[model samples]
Target: MPELPEVEVIRRGLAPGLLGRRILRLVIGEKRLRRESSPEKFQEWLPGRVILDLERRGKYLLFRLEGGVTLLLHLGMTGRLLLGPGPSPPRPHVHLVLELEGGLDLAFQDVRRFGQALVFPPGAEPDPLAQVGREPFSREVTPEWLAQEARARSRTIKNFLMDGRVLAGIGNIYASEILFAARLHPGMPAGRLSPADWGRVLKETRRILNAAIAKGGTTVSDYLNSRGETGLFQLELSVYGREGEPCRRCGRAVARISQGGRSTFFCPRCQKKK
Candidate 1:
């Protein structure tokens, strides 16, 4: 699934191509998604309205429309958004297509069919990103705030970061990367962590996320930009997928463990259990 940086990259890529232009055609090939919102409702509420702007909340893309309506999209595992003009062959899983004012066809292709498309009529839906925990880049998300939150919770550190209720925009891949950057163990109990540990986690979270945004996000498998280009951040990862390989920080072998049913890579020596 596309995480926060990936979603942000999508929003940035789609902004120029989608802004100002009117959505002439609305096509929906699939409707089964996380929410109960239907394709028909999307076409009904959208189309004629101008695309005011593009917004993102957590992992969801919010295409703000005229009259305060928002089109919510979640790119589950294999979802891809392709844009541009000229002759372009459509993918086999092109589920949604929005015809622009000209002759452009902005397509939403998803092979896994786990993505979602929903319409939020004026204030009907809240911004999931804004509703989640303090953004790492936000001024409100200070090291002290992270320490307090960690001190108040008893969940594992990695799980705490991944929980949308505690903090939004962090997925499995990022949680591992962030922990590696902080040299902290994923399975460490949150409340048991020292203030210094919390400070390291918060600082590294911002550093890693900013570096990712600068690199256009990470593309481990199927993630692609609007232009079908892969991201450049994967090369900078320290322990995300280097399982069984040598750790970047230490010479010890990087190990992979199943936590919360997800594969997490970390150096046992570097990130020791407390």
Candidate 2:
């Protein structure tokens, strides 16, 4: 699935083309996504509304439309949002296509069919974003705040960071990179981290996430930008996918371990266990 950085890249790519464009029609696929709005509801609420702005919360994309309606999209694993001239190519799993006024087709293609599309009315809070925590770069996510929330949690530090409810937009890939950058072991307990350790974690988290966004996010299998380009961040990964490979900081080989069913990669010598 696309994380925060990947989704942000998509938002930036699509905003200019989508903004000020009114939806002339919505074409629903025969196959349904994980969650989808009814065809009648889509037709009634979507057409004639102009896209005013595009916003991203966690991994969800919000298309602010005229008249207080918001078009919500979640590009689940193997999903791609592409902007193309005229009608899109006849693809196998194109779930939703928005025919815009200026001869543009906003296509939502999901090979795995795990994506979600919904139309939210004015003043309505999206359920997927309801429990999302603060942005990593936000001022509200200080070391003190992270320590406070982690004080009672016995989960591993990696798991804690990956939890969307605690810190939105981080997934397996970035969690490992952040931990590696902070020089912390993934198996360390969240509650055991000191405030100073939390400080390092927070700092590295922001730095890594920002760098990932600049590189267009990590393409670890099924992630692509709105222009169908693979991410460059994976080329610069420190430890996430370099299992058994030599560590950049230390001479020792990078190690891989499974936690909560997700693979974590780090340098055993550099990221000391406490």
Q: What TM-score fits each model?
A: 0.91, 0.97
CA deviation > 4 Å runs, candidate 1: 86-88, 127-131, 231-233
Candidate 1: minimum summed lDDT over ten consecutive residues — where? 28-37
Using lDDT, give the best candidate's number. Answer: 2
Pairs of residues clashing in candidate 1: 57-129
State candidate 1's TM-score: 0.91
Each candidate's number of clashing pairs is 1, 0
lDDT of 1 by residue, 209-252 (tens): 77777778888768888887874556477888888889988789
For candidate 1, the lDDT comes to: 0.80
**What range of 10 consecutive residues in model 2 has the weakest lDDT sum?**
226-235
